[model samples]
Target: MTAARLGPQERDAALRAMADTELDVLVVGGGIVGAGVALDAVARGLSVGLVEARDFASGTSSRSSKLIHGGLRYLEHLDFPLVREALTERGLLLSRIAPHLVRPVPFLFPLRSHWERPYIGAGVALYDALALSGTRTRGLPGHRHLSRRAALRIFPALRRDALVGAVQYWDAQVDDSRYVVMVLRTAATYGAHIASRTQAVGFLREGEHVTGARVVDLETGREFAVRAKQVVNAAGVWTDEIQEMVGGRGQIHVRASKGVHLVVPRDRIHASSGLILRTEKSVLFVIPWGRHWILGTTDTAWDLDKVHPAASRTDIDYVLNRVNAVLKTPLTRDDVEGVYAGLRPLLAGESEETSRLSREHTVAHPVPGLVLIAGGKYTTYRVMAKDAVDAVAHGLGGGVPPSVTDRLPLVGADGYFALWNQRRILARRTGLHVSRIQHLLRRYGSLIHEVLGLIAEQPDLKQPLTGADDYLRAEVVYAVRYEGARHLDDVLSRRTHIAIETWDRGLAAAEEAAQLMAGPLGWDDAQIAREVEYYRARIEAERAAQEQDSDQEADAVQHGAPDIVPQATTVRV
Candidate 1:
């Protein structure tokens, strides 16, 4: 297979190719499901083209709780199939698809009462059993019942009175944004035309049959019609808006559920394993991220500002209050390194609460040539993609082959294990620490050479960013030259995660990162300054928004910072 390079050159070439050729499948939205759809279609011998309005995974996909697990909470609702399917996909991701990006992480579920032990224990046992039954290799250890003292041994920072016992179970975590980019790269390798910062302005139709979409390149403001046999609307939260362009009442109604997460220094929570605490509405996860603890996720209905979902002061306080209820040392706003908010695209159901909405996705031929897929969790993105492509196949008169994505390993997965085992040798040869090589292995897998090669040409690239030492300078250059990072936010927020891991929210690294990015993207001094200023303004707006009391107020504050890439005005056909 050819190595897929999604650099600026490739992106320009893709847009031109998309305009010139009529594709078998045109995928709108570059989130997890959309990327999955592109990969699935192209791998199945179909010509595919994917367009994202902004940077890839810049929406809900980047801002997930970062877990790849069967929804343990959904088992309470007796949704067995969803749990089983997600577990199967999780197993595939860990064992086959993207082992470098996905790995098992243990979570301790504190048992409040004696009865709660067996209750939660049984649920966890069932979870493990379901995972085991789904795939040949479960890819993680089974759940363990722990005494209060034993639990405290694993999680020293837990409040003693919080629980009598605990249930420790395994779930996988991933760099959500990175995984999306890898998936798109993998898709591109299979001949999918991938273009970012491109928006679908309107649908192209002929006598009531949707034939294609009229897309505008946000970077250059060039509008062109991308002709395709089928169009898949995998636009997550923007599904309704996409549907409106075609003047159709979408069969599927998607509601946005805002989930906010707080990132703090790793020292703040001295837990070996992550924590999953039950809330009145849902479960709150204290996920273990590298050098930090990610405490998150308040499930509330959101009706405003889909582009940048803002986390309010109330949202922050709610998470702190819930997490502090069980922590020996309470966390404060000052302890928070960064905060991010994302919206979950939920299928509207009979329940009034957003938490109760269906996570099971639906694929519809709302129009003859348009296939819309919405309302699935991140873990089951592959299944969602398969289903969406199945609809596309039906719309194309059914000669398309079945999906081969389940057997396909993503780009970095092939030689990851071999390279990981030789990390010491790589470290010695590159004159870097083994730990740094390990970090690079986990992030880029076998593709570490592409990054290291940059360091070899310019040895200074091996040095770490001034404020965010976790990432090397070479990684920033690689993000633009290979990973399709179009802006400063793309590098800091998604590609490297300096924005959420740093104390100043990447403010210190913004200028340096922009300067590094300038050479490859051909940015002048003014453009570099503008990129830094926009990033600073964005961080400022997010900080101010977090102080607001309500979502509306937070949305207004967040909207105060203009987007670096101007949003395409949807031209109704």
Candidate 2:
């Protein structure tokens, strides 16, 4: 396999190559599903090109709940197939695909009433059984029932009267943005042409048949055409917009459902395991992230600003009130370190509530030479990719091979276990702490050598960032040099997650990170200053938006900060 270095040089080469060649498949999104589609198509031996208007996973993909489970709540809806498929993919990710990035996390489902134990217990049992029923190895432990005392012992933060008992079940979690980048990297290794900050402005057509796309490099504002035999639209919430570029609506309509999450310090939540609480409209998860607890998710209709979904004060208050009901020590607004909102691309349905819409995906050849895929959960991204590529194959007269992604390990997964075992030795050799080595192993797996190589050349790179101590200075450099992070936001928001993980929302680290990124990205002092200013403005805008009472007000406030790269407008062909 080729080295999956998505640096500046590789990105330039990809753009030139994509423009020069007529690809067998061209994908129009860089979210998880689009990344998966690229990987699946390339692994199937097709010439593939993937373009993203912004950074990878900049949309809904990066803003997920970050769980890889069988959707235990889906069992109540009698959606066994969706749950089973997600479980299979979850197992594959943990064991075979991206072990370095994904790991199992335990969650406590607090039982409210005596009768609810047996009711929810059956659902949990079925969830476990469905996981086992899959062909892939079940990488997590089974669920366990706990008495009230045992539940309290494990989760002392829970209010005494809140639960009669609890059920502890295991699910996998991942840094969603990082995983998307890794997936694209793996796809690049398989010969997929990958380029971020490139937008599809319009579709190329030959007398009503979609043949390719007219694209613009967002960084340089250079317009070009990428000719492709088959075009796959995995544009998630922007599916309708992409379809409109083709001059009409596709077979399905995608509606945006806003979900908001609050990040609080882990010390605030005194639990050995994460909590899954029941809400009136949907389920709420208090997930255990590194050194922090991610409490969230308000599901409501959102029609504004798909790119930057804003979490209103009402949304934050709703989450706090819901989680506070079961917590012994109620959390306040002051406890929140960060807030983020993402839109779910649900297939529009008859139900008025966004929560009632389908999580299942659909693929349609709305026009010849064009395939549209939308509306799937994150965990089942591979399956969605496979199906989308299958549609592409059919469009290309059906000669494409089956998807080999299920058996293919991502770039960092192959030797992760060995690297993990030798972390202490690595630490000793590099004069770094074992904990630091372990952290690198979890994030980069066998690819830790690539990061350590930068540190070997510059000893100062080993030091942790001033604001986000969890990450090293080398990470910012790595994000620019190897991970295709073109801007400060790419590193702070997606690549390193310093934006949402820090108390100051990465404001303190912006100048340093921009300086570190300058050498590789060729950003002069002016550009560096501009990058820092843009990030600071973004942080301020988000803070202002979070204070608003409604989504409309919040969205308007969040839009105050213009995108660092001007958004490309779609032109009608």
Candidate 3:
């Protein structure tokens, strides 16, 4: 089967089809859950339309800790069902669903005291057991205990006094934003109309039932109506705001909880494995990325701007301080390469603290033709999508088939294992190093050929990007030609992760990448300069925001860089 193409022309055609065709389900939001819902619905023989207000996974889905695990901490809270369900999903993703994008990463949980070993070990044993109970958990290694001396050997960056011992366990990691795009691409392949940079202004309702939506293309300021029988709101942090469009609060409230992460170069930390530390409010993860280590997350209540969640000086200090307590050589602000903050859409409970709020999603059909699915983690998106579509199936009422997405591998998954086995052969054929071929295989899987094809046509595309050596020039072109990237920010921030991966926040490659993208995007000299200027302004704004102490101050500073794709000032839907 041919892979789906999501280039500019295809996106325009999708938008036109969404306006012209009557769909069975219209999924609003382009995050992981929305993308999953689109794939599920279309796979079930239902005509589907997926619309996003911003770029796909620009919100919380893009800014996660990048772990696909069973929520090990949730076991302490006795949320067995959530943990079990997530573990099952983790197994499926590792083995079946997206082997290319998702792979296992080892995490060492340091024990502070000798007495804590058995206690923590029991929890981890349960975690591994739950995962193994699943039918597809064959490849991942189980948890193992290591002596303090042995643990220190594996992670020399950890202070010897930081732990009495450690427990090592496996969890899968992903390039979260890329995974979302791949899911959408798979859905598009299955015949779903998809449009990004399109804002849903209002619901098209007939007497009290939502029939469709009034959407505007942010790129071209063109407004049109998309007609559908059922509309699913998977708008993440913006769920409550979308619900207000229909009438009342819609029987569910989603609270925004902010989480922050810091990216530091790998050489700064002499650790071979990732580290997971327990904190006062939540867990802190020092995750391993390709050329960098991702240290994150502070869980705090946030009521500020949701579009651009800013990580203030206070938040950065909190994370650094928490991780520094265990590091042999503490990481200073200068050591940090990037900082990002994302909001978690928690189902508002009686608890005042967002950390205590449940991650389990809630589905509600407050009205006849509308469904709202909110408050799940990145790991359980497929389940949430299945449930959302199941509700839509019920609403549709007939011989609507159940979800077959579990059996359906994503577009890149089909020939991945075979290609992975032949990485050396591919390296010889492409004249690229074996290590480079391995990187491409991990990213594009079987679709690596499409990327190689570009280099095959133009050998210059094989050269590494200007500042970000890990990525090739071919990737920047590929993002525009096939992956639906419209602006310089899209390529740097989401498509290749050059923004967070580089110390300059991709400023060094801004002009080079924009020039590369200009050819495919049909940008003139003026437009290319404008795109570069916008990206630089954004980097400066974020840098200034990081220096601020509070969310309010940071938000004020960050909003200085306005979005290129202007959204509606006022909503009628």
Instruction: List the candidate 2 regions with Cα displacement exceeding 4 Å.
Output: none
- In candidate 1, stretches whose alpha carbon ends up further than 4 angstroms from where it belongs are none
lDDT of 2 by residue, 1-573 (tens): 545888999999999999999999999999999999999999999999999999999999999999987888888899999999999999999999989999999999999999998899999999988998876574588899999999999999999999999999999999899999999999999899999999999999998788899999999999999999999999999999999987775897999999999999999989999999999888999999988999989999999989889999999999999999999999999999988899999999999999999999999999899999999999999999999999999999987889898998998887899889898899889999999998898888888999999998999999998888899999999998889999999999998878888889999999999999999999899999999999999999999999999988998999999889998878976
Steric clash count of candidate 2: 0
Instruction: Report the error of model 1 at residue 64, Å.
Output: 0.4
- Give the candidates in order of lDDT, highest first: 1, 2, 3
Model 1: per-residue Cα lDDT over 1-573, one tens digit each: 656999999999999999999999999999999999999999889999999999999999999999999999999999999999999999999988999999999999999999998789899999999999965554688899999999999999999999999999999999999999999999999899999999999999997888999999999888999999999999999999998888856898999999999999999999899999999999999999989999989999999989999999999999999999999999999999989999999999999999999999999897789999999999999999999999998988988899888889998899999999999999999999999999999998988888999998999999999899999999999999999998999999999899999989999999899999999999999999999999999999999999999988999999999999989789666
Candidate 1 residue-wise lDDT at 158: 95
Residue 528's lDDT in candidate 2 = 98
- The sequence of per-residue lDDT tens digits that candidate 3 reaches over residues 1-573 is 888888999998999899888999999999999999999999999999999988888999999999998999999999999999999998888888999999999999999999999999999999988887877554589899999999998899999999999999999899999999999999999899888898888899898889999999998989999999999999999998898888765877999999999999999999999999999888999999998999999999999889999989999999999999999899999999999999999999999999999899989998878999998899999999999999999889867898887778887898899999999999999889999999999888899999999998989999999998899999999998888899999899998888999989999999999999999889999999999999999999999999999999999999999987768853645
Q: Model 1, 357: alpha-carbon shift in Å? A: 0.4
